[model samples]
Target chain A: MIRFENVGMRYGAGPEVLRDISFELKPGSFHFLTGASGAGKSSLLRLMYLAHRPSRGLITILDEDIATIPRNRLPELRRKIGVVFQDFRLMSHLTCFENVALPLKINGAGSGVIKKYVSELLNWVGLADQANARPATLSGGQKQRAAIARAVISRPKLLVADEPTGNVDDALAVRLLFLFEELNRQGTTVLIATHNESLIRRFRHPVLHLEDGQLVPSPLRPIVPLRDRAPPPPDSRRFSDPIYPDAPGEGGRHG
Target chain B: MAKRRGDIPLGNDPASRLLPWIIGFMAFIAALALSGALVLAAFSDRWSAGLTGTLTIQIPPPAAYDDEAGFEALQKEALAAVRRTPGVASATLLPLDEMRALLKPWLGAGADPRDLPLPRLIAVTLEAGEDVDLADLGRRLEALAPGITIDDHGLWRERLTDFMAALQLAALAVVAVVALAAVVMVIFATRGGLLAHRESIELLHLIGAHDRYIAAQFQGQTLFAAIKGGIAGTGMAAGTVVLLGHGAAATGAVLPGALVLEPMAWLWVMTVPMALIVIAVLTARRTVVNALVRMV
Candidate 1:
């Protein structure tokens, strides 16, 4: 869980980027962060990811005041949070397998566990066949999928994605969000920063919209929510209590 | 204590693999300069002490009319005066034949000694715990015999001392220059490695890897290479000194060359490797830390 109260950030004498930002993310909660370009979406994600320090105000992650954490203890805190960058910052020299297993390795996971977990995650993301290939050899969408696999491999407590679907076709994007939703259903908190309104409308999860360096409450929609019409579960375990059940099941098919 | 996941595989990078060779090369140079100075100092000390502890009194050849009487008269006075001096442990006027024999090496064995107008010579030796004061001794010898002049080897010893000091300075300068070069090279190599792996470095930093973790890797690698090189170089230098000692013993005469081989002093060769390892570790730590501070 992340809680920020009156948190503000700036970049070296530049204008205040995220001002008086405060929010709470409950366990297993899912939310969409929406904003136009330069709306500090990435900056806010950075703060949540523990990459940048807040210039002022209190920020807590998992009930610990992050600003007061000793530098040596930061890695342990970071291991619990996974991030997928917009650029898919994979090391070109490393194979897809190595890239995805990086987080586990940094956490000193055993070799056997890493091999099994990475294989399972890569297979889940539909890149098991390209596991031996390097990032340069993968297509944009393939790289995005690999990045998502990497982000979710460790089953991090908080998953922050910046434009996770920007490079993929619409169908793949929806499936990726479903994957994040599935993880969230299993108790991982998910926060996605994207500008795609149609996707937000399709998924009725709470939206945290940003404009002019400040948070704006998202207006609630009165339309019939998609979760109300679902068929009865064949078995109780067969269906998850969906966080974004109204999110579209299919929109644009890639193939 | 957090570990870093280095993306760049520790493979056979030519530069990294060549590290031992580079260190060995540096240690070789260090040994060459240090041992050379040691040899020079030993030789200079030996030759100067030998030459300074003795003096020769030369009486100019007697005029043709004065004959052997003039030689005998001056020789007795020189011997009598030398014997009375406090620091003159023993003084004996060299026989004409003995003086002639000294010139045989330069003039060749077949040369006739009688033909040369050799000066009358007195060879003086000094006692332990006493040094001949040349200034005072010269006045006494001159009063004893008007034509006698003394040589206490001061001019030669002074020149040798000055030359030895210069050689020691030169040796020290070489050591300083080599150490400086090593530090600079380490900085250059570290900077290049950092740039080459900038992505990994940034990722590590973002993930909260401390500066010490990054620096330790570089320092450990450098230290291993330096120690390996130092051992190899010092071994080679020791072997060379041993070989020289053998040659010197077989010759059974002090060689004219002034480089003295002190075989037992090779024990001090351990310092070369120790110094090299320390320098490398320190330089690497500083370079890595400085680079990381600039990154975040």
Candidate 2:
């Protein structure tokens, strides 16, 4: 679904942050992106999401050359891809439900359909009870889950997540991975960027490693394990109280 | 969608909300200047039309002769010449006392009427839509008496016309300058608003919102403010004009029913708000689009 050949990107006239990058992902395939801090992983994802133009080479998404596509058509192309940001960039003023429903609304979906689907997705992510709560009232883990739900709400054909499990616990991280795995099985290509070595070892997907400004393909690839996996407890189990706190009204500041 | 998320979190910045008021004030000044020019033009047109095809035939003093007999013969000859003219509607000879009263204000109250050798005045009214043949009339008058001067009043009327045209041009120039300044100010204010909301705007951009959508939000908010400002400013200007007209009316001599503001002038003042709203909307839209295009 996505192909990048000899792509290079730089901010202003400075040296390139992502250089000589080349990659191809078939439809419904899954991959992992790994690197240390300042390894140009975010810059690569920014390019993939159509936020930045490649300074040097060809970048194609869904069989069309992105560099040649007119700017007025960029929004339609962006609607086909989903991104989970590392910072959980949810509008603080919006309720959890509104945050998740953004992608559907932007696509001009019918209101009734959006409401039903967004609520179900929130329920799947274990935040149905906190749907009306603001992002600031929710804990870090709750915010992360909300962001993930928002990214996948439109069932985007391509999903890119940067540190999707950063704020969650180990079990919750595994649960989130299972969600990604389920999405892939349902034919959504996934590219996840993370620093969790243990999590990487547990998954059997091919890894795209980045060092400095170059892409280094892994020589030893793990075969896919032949069994369905489920995320574990105590998040998997019923908690004593609600996962997120109640939101304060009237004095809340919206940005 | 999704219950609108509480009014879009717009007009959050104080400056953004206040921008419309500034535009409105500028629009008000524009309305006042334009209306003033229109009134001046109308007043000048009326004065010129009243004085244009007519003349005051002043009978000069007859040398080495009796003053009364000379004046009577001049009056009879001037009346007969005016009646024979094609465009003359009516010719009336003023009495001596009346002519003295006409010059009383300028020449002073204590001046001796008998000592002053004032010219005999003949008030000639012309047909409203007809032009007088001034050369033919002048020849006829010279044949009757060489001392009579036919004043068609063109010189004074031309001076008044030039003065009115200049006033109109100056007023129009003031309106143009105010409009230009308003657009520039709006651009600056919109840029400041964008900078203040930079974080929110970036997040919206990352979420696949196009530049046009973001621009619409800013333009819509600014336009609303401009309309409110326009109405307030224009209303104030109209009130001031009416108050000035009333004050001028109270003084019965300088502007004796001649300083009236026309209805069309008031109608133009009413359009000030709409012009301001359009300017605010367009300027905000352009500024936001330019700023957003620099992002990617």
Candidate 3:
């Protein structure tokens, strides 16, 4: 679970890229982050993934304050969250199999476990034949699939994808989205940042829309003021009930 | 099979090859300096022990009595006086031929030593563990023959010891300078390697790899290179030392027999390469960890 209240972030004295942003992600839920170019979608994702510190306000991930966590302890938190970058930042020297196996290795997984899961996930993403190929040798769509497999291989508690389908065709993009949905059904929280509204329409997940360093209210899911929402239940199954009830709207409006 | 964890390909960078050669050259200099110090120390100890409690008595040819019999009588009296000393173990007169051989360096190959007014020399040995009053003995010898003088070889021994000490100190300084240079070179190489592999490092970091994990890759590469270079350098130094010892022995050089290192000294020299490897590994690890601290 992640909660951000009045979080404002800027890069090295530049004007604030994400300002007065507030959102919450319940466990086992999926949401789409929508914005135009330079709408601070990536910046928001970076903060959520513990890559950057916000200049102002509080961020609590998994019920722990981000500002107070020691730098040494941040790696442990990072290992629990898997991030798929828009550029698909796979190590070029590593082959496809090695790239996807990285997260498992970092977690100190056994060789047998790594081979079994990495191989299975690569096959699922239709990259089994390309497993031995380097990133340079793979096509863009293949590279994206490999990156997705790497992100989900560890089965992290929270999964973040930045423009996961940016480099892939519509069919491939739909298939990748289904992969994310399958992961979510198994209890992993997913927040995907993209500008593709047609995909959002095809999948009726709640949307967090950003415009000019602030969150713009989406017609389908109404924004509730931080003070207006009731306290979450003390039980572990707080996400058993939907946070935002289903709202009817056309999904391709943002696109 | 899945690739082994933490087995990243870090040492393959072409620029990383520079560290080993630098370490090897440094190891060579360090081994040479260490060997020189050890040899000098051994020689000094031997000379000091040999010269202790010993004396040399030289009686110049008596000017008043030029005949051979007159010189013989004076020499006989001097030998008798030395034998009477309580701590004197044995005293023997140098044959005329032997005296001429000692003068060969200054008197030239064909010069007759008998024509020159060379002093009659008596070699004196002392009783083991006995202390002789050298000044008292010198006065007694001078009384026996007015021109007779005692040389204990103390002055030359002390001077040799001091000279050897200074040489050893200089060699130690060379070793220290070489070690400092090696550390600096390793630091620079580690930073350059980090820069070249910046993307890899960043990816590793983002995926939750500890700083130590990243540093180990660089440290392992440097350590291997250092060991390889150190062996080459130390091997050359050992070969040079052995060859020089043989050359000196064949030429009948004045150097002491201790110039050829004992087994223990060779063992000490063997540690030079190992020491260099440790330094390289530590320097690379520190440089990399510091650089990583500056990142996310």
lDDT (10s digit) by residue, model 2, range B1-296: 01122324556666776676787679779888977888888889888988875788888767654667866887798888887899889988878898777778887778866667777778899998888887888888888788888888889998999999999999989988988888998888888888877877776666667888789878877767787778888888888778778888887638555556788767876877787788878988999999988875
List candidate 3 segments past 4 Å from native: A219-255, B1-8, B46-54, B61-63, B66-71, B84-89, B97-117, B127-136, B246-259
Instruction: Give the C-alpha miss distance for residue B147 in model 3, angstroms.
Output: 5.4
* Candidate No. with top lDDT: 3
Q: At residue B258, what lDDT does model 3 achieve?
A: 57
lDDT of 1 by residue, B138-228 (tens): 7886776566688778899999899988998898788778778777776666666677666677676654456776677677767766777
lDDT of each: 0.75, 0.79, 0.82
> In every candidate, what fraction of the native interface contacts is reproduced?
0.32, 0.39, 0.39
Candidate 2 residue runs with Cα over 4 Å from true position: A129-133, A217-228, A231-255, B1-10, B102-111, B251-253, B257-259
- In model 2, residue pairs whose N, Cα or C atoms come closer than 3 Å (at least 3 residues apart or on different chains), thus clashing, are none
**What's the ranking of the predictions by DockQ, best on top?**
3, 2, 1
TM-score of each: 0.71, 0.86, 0.85
Tens-digit lDDT track for model 3 on B35-69?
99999888888889889867888999867546889
Give the per-residue lDDT digits (tens) of candidate 2, residues A1-255: 799999999987999999999999998888999888999999999888877888999999867798788777777677667799999988787899999888777666677877777877788788999999999999999999999998877666689999999999987788888778766765678999988776777777879999897998654454435363333433332211111113232111100
TM-score (chain B) for model 2?
Answer: 0.91
Which scores better on TM-score, 1 or 2? 2
What's the DockQ of model 2?
A: 0.36
Total clashes for model 2: 0
- Candidate 1 Cα deviation (angstroms), residue A163: 1.8
